[model samples]
Target: MTVKQLSSSGQFNILCMPEPEREIDGVYIGDLLSWVMGKAEADNVWITIMSNINVIAVASLSDVSCVLLAEDVTLESDVLNTAKEKGINILSTPLSAYEAALKVSGMI
Candidate 1:
């Protein structure tokens, strides 16, 4: 499923979607920045409770289609700006990481 389609499913709130049409190939759930950077695949939806500037950098380096912020975690203003500038798509949900992953799994 595409990022846009997933966002429209009402499971998440759109934070910044610079590439909503980007396709989701899979899901990666992690909070460790370095581990996620090394393991997350291109076009995968990275699910995490992390909401920092480094998260943006890792997402860029990992080339994930989007960052799914679980537990309604949100990036700071500066980090959100950086994400927009880098064309990183982001979404947030009230569910925990595992719950969010289940939702995404069912979708894509």
Candidate 2:
């Protein structure tokens, strides 16, 4: 599924969607930035509760299609703006990481 399609489905809230047409090829769930940076594949829908500025950096470095902020986790204005400026797609959901993964699994 594409980032725009996923956000339009109402499963997640769009925080920063500079690349809304980006396609989601897979899902990666984790909180540790280092681990995620290594494990998250390009075009994967990364699911995590981390809302820090580094999350944006890791997302860019990992080349993930989008960052799924689980459990309603939110980013600060500066981080959100950075995500927008960096052309990173960041989404949020009220569901836990596992639950959100399940939902993404069904969708993809």
Candidate 3:
């Protein structure tokens, strides 16, 4: 399913907008920045508790579809702004990345 679709479906929340939906139909990876950049694939829905500018940087470098800042974490204003400019989609979620991962896994 597409990112928008997934969000509206109530299965997952869309933390970022204008994001590509790649891994939604497959799997989700909820690792930290370093591991995610090396191991996650493009179009994958990346869920992490981190809510910093670096997360956006990692998402951009890795070409991820979107990022879910889970566990009630939020990004800095500048980070969100930069991500928007970079065409990176980052979403904030009430649930932690671990929770989102589990829900996403069960759906796919």
Name the top lDDT candidate. 1
RMSD per candidate (Å) reads: 0.6, 0.6, 2.3
Q: Give each model a TM-score.
A: 0.97, 0.97, 0.80
Across residues 17-50, which tens digit of lDDT does each residue of candidate 3 receive?
A: 7655544544456656789988888777787777
lDDT of 2 by residue, 1-108 (tens): 899998998788998899989999899999999999888899999999888899999999899999999999988999999999999999999999999999888898
Clashes of each: 0, 0, 7
Model 2 residue runs over 4 Å out of place are none
Candidate achieving higher lDDT, 1 or 3: 1
**Candidate 3 local Cα displacement, residue 16, angstroms:** 3.6
| Model 1: lowest-lDDT 10 consecutive positions | 70-79
User: For model 3, which pairs clash?
Assistant: 15-90, 15-91, 16-90, 16-91, 23-43, 71-95, 71-96
In candidate 1, what are the lDDT values of residues 3-80, reduced to their tens digit?
999999998999999998999989999999989988889999999998878998899989999999999887899999
- Quantify all predictions' global Cα lDDT against the true fold: 0.94, 0.93, 0.70
Among all windows of ten consecutive residues in candidate 3, which has the lowest summed lDDT?
19-28
Q: Is candidate 2 or candidate 3 better by TM-score?
A: 2
